[model samples]
Target: MAELPLSGLLVLDFSQFLAGPSCALRLADLGADVVKVERPQGGDLCRQLYVADLALDGDSALFHTINRNKRSVAADLKDPADLEAVKRLVARADVMIHNFRPGVMERLGLGFDAVAALNPRLVYGAVSGYGDEGPWRDKPGQDLLVQSLSGFVWLSGNADQGPTPAGVSVTDILTGAHLAQGILAALVRRGVTGRGGRVDVSLMESALDMQFEQLTTFLNTDRAQPRRSAVAHANVHIAAPYGVYQTADGYLALAMTPVDRLAELLDCAALEPFRDRSTWFIERDAIKAVIADHLMTRPTADWLAVLEAAGVWAAEVMTWPRLVEHDAFKALDVTQLIESAGGGTLLTTRCPIRIDGRILTSPRGAPRLGADTAAMLEEPMLDGNARVGE
Candidate 1:
């Protein structure tokens, strides 16, 4: 087997919660040595941030899912001895990440300037709710709040319904991805210049970036608000036949198919007159209503057979159970089971990226709180002026 891309890299993760830890997790997935720095008392608050009330090995399943393949070290920034140890680790690390509010790091004497002075080749990554100097900088960087603030909530559901945030913490995940991208770019630059740079990402900025297509349209089109169809519209900008409709047995989703072709295929006389492409957006609701009523007359499998035969873009809308059990899903082989140090096991999705046709898989689970503190502190270089991992 080939060695992983980031085998020798060292990452110091001082961030808690989703955004920062997720970035470090990706680094670890690529075989970076990631050490999660957490407060000594309870470690990362996310250890208890249960999703669906699920816990694994005394930590939240969500925490276990994200923090796999990483070690943990406990240190209180307020303690001079512990802070000194962390600074030494930072100096040896190739990458450092944190999601503290604007002045928190500076107050702890580990801001970018201080850390960069100690190690000029350290890539400092930071995540915030908003930009560091904005009016909303002091606000909590929670995913749901960022979604609401960035107008992401208005993008989903029908016209009459209230604002609906996404089912997941999309902003946090996107911000993590952006931070990772920036970190990688900085690493590439550092390879040439031997000087690391700061990479900053904000939840609001990431949330806005996620809607680039629709947001660009809205910005250039007279500032008009997105007009969602009264019926089952998938995207605010897309025309008819771009949503899920209820079939007799299940739901069927349709992508952008020509109205005349669909009318001929489904034998719907009402759809024949809307052959002109210009009316698709304007009469989207009306066209969707007709399509919905017609689709309900047949089972999802029957419509899928016809649509598949007609070369139309359509599929059955499957729930999680059906999706996981499908042959196509199983063929991907994207899930893995990880065992924690305490002997607890969890079945979770693996990293989506593949290198050289090999899926990245590791058996390591999240560390018990401060599990590596003694070993890390006892390293030979930590006691002298030399860097911790040097």
Candidate 2:
């Protein structure tokens, strides 16, 4: 097999929960030798952050899901000896990631400037709930709270419905993605200049970025808040026929389609009066109500077949079980098996990236807390000036 692009790179993951660790997880997936630096006791807080109360080995499934393909070292940064050892490790790492509030790392003596002084080529990535100088910087950076504060909650649900947050931690995940992108760019720059850089991202910024399209419209227009559609609301700024509607058997999602074309295709004359493009936005609720009634007359599959055959962007809204069973999902080959420290396997997703047309897969799962500490501390490189791959 071709060598992964990030082979021989060393990344130290000093963050917990989702944003920082998710960024580190991607680095590991791309073949970086990522090591998690955690507290001697408990390790990543996410080890106990259970979702559906699922677990594998001794850690929550959520922890195993994000933390696979990485090693762990336990150390108390408060202890002088452990802090010195971590500093040595920092000197050798090509990259390091952390999610701490502003000044926390500085208080811990591991801020970007200090670490860059130790390793000039290090790419330091930091994640915060908000930017360091912002008024909201010190607030807790939890995903749900960030989503609520970033104007994201108002974008979903029908007009009559109250503000609704996404079921997933989209802000955390998107912030991680942004951190990874910035880190990658910094690394590219480092390759040219042989100097490291700091990359910072915040959940609030990422949340706003996730709604760039709608936010851009709001900014460029009269600065009036865009109202959610009264019916089948999907996007705050989109017109009718752009949301999920209940069919006889299930839900069907429709994307942008010409109102006239949809009326002819579905054989519904109620949409005929609102066929003009201008009315699509003004009468979106009425047009969607008519479409909803017409769609309820047929099954989702029946409507999907017709809409699909005509090249209209439509699909049956599928549950997880149904989606996993579909041929299209299977064709993607997105799942993989990873083994925990206890030697048991858990099925999870592989890296979505394909380098050299090869899907990245690692059989290794997350390590036990401090599993590699002894080995790491005993390394001869720590006593010498050499780094990994040197």
Candidate 3:
């Protein structure tokens, strides 16, 4: 079959942090030629995110997930010579990606306007903390800050307790995803017009976009923020019998959305109270309490098996180890064994979608710091006229 969509595209990635590198990674996965440009001394900060004090001998897990299928070139952009070389690289590139603050690249004389002038076909991709320019533009915008600003962090944790931040770097991931989308769209437009355009993505914007429903609700209503639905937050709510129930075996979430199904699955006397949608809140609270009491009587596994068999969606709330080991996980190809430090294998979550039934990209290890610097930065100094060698 033909190579993945971006085969002939050349992406010069001047990004180290999550958002920028992730977009390059996505392009790499699609078979684009992605060359990561990093500083000579430490390279991308991400390489040290998980395991501090990292070296080429030990790439961090956080780095590997977003940097695979990319080649690295170490160059000190502050040096005039190296900066010129990057311009040369951009002149020949189909895409240039960066996550530096608004004017950083411009100060280095490597901004989109200059590079685009050099190569009309170059697609410039930029990711910012707040935006290129705004009241909050100069403020440091990390994933944590974006999460807190976007209301994502506010909804997390239980309703009663202070909101807990998501364990993962969701804002970075969301921004990266948006950057990839913008790049793809720009590529399509460039194909039609024979001129590439700038693709801008902001973490603040992406995070807010992600909270679409909540934002929309607040926009139209008087509520300042979305009230967390009690039934949805607690896997087991006192008012809804459909939430997860406990058993002597294990915990399994109850799939009792429909009133009839809830009644039948829970073996309750009736669900007339549920039919009155106006009071789902009141009814859900009471019903959840009853379900909780009933579930406490059995083992989790027993409850899960009974509920699942009865067509109520249910699964054991699995731990990381148990989840990967579960037969269902194996059947679904949701995990892959990747080579970690010491040549030992570590289980990593596979990408959510499968292409042609393939779960993970064929085990290309993360590039060591500036591993390709020698080959990349070496002078291949033929002028454009002579380089073509027609």
TM-score of each: 0.96, 0.96, 0.87
Query: Alpha-carbon error at 187 in model 1, in Å?
Result: 0.6
Shift in Å, residue 83, candidate 3: 0.3
C-alpha-based local distance difference test score of model 1: 0.89
User: Over the full model, what C-alpha lDDT does candidate 2 score relative to the true structure?
Assistant: 0.89
Ten contiguous residues with the weakest lDDT in model 1? 381-390
- A best-first ranking of the candidates according to their lDDT comes to 1, 2, 3
Which sections of candidate 2 miss by over 4 Å? 381-390
What would the per-residue lDDT of candidate 2 be over residues 135-181, giving only the tens digit for each residue?
Answer: 78799999999889988999999999998999999999999999999
Q: What are the Cα lDDT values of the candidates?
A: 0.89, 0.89, 0.72
Q: Pairing residues by index, what is the TM-score of model 1?
A: 0.96
- Runs in model 3 with CA error above 4 Å? 51-56, 229-246, 269-275, 336-353, 356-360, 381-390
Q: Give the C-alpha miss distance for residue 110 in model 2, angstroms.
A: 0.8
Q: Residue 320 error for model 2, in Å? A: 1.1
| Winner by lDDT between candidate 3 and candidate 2 | 2
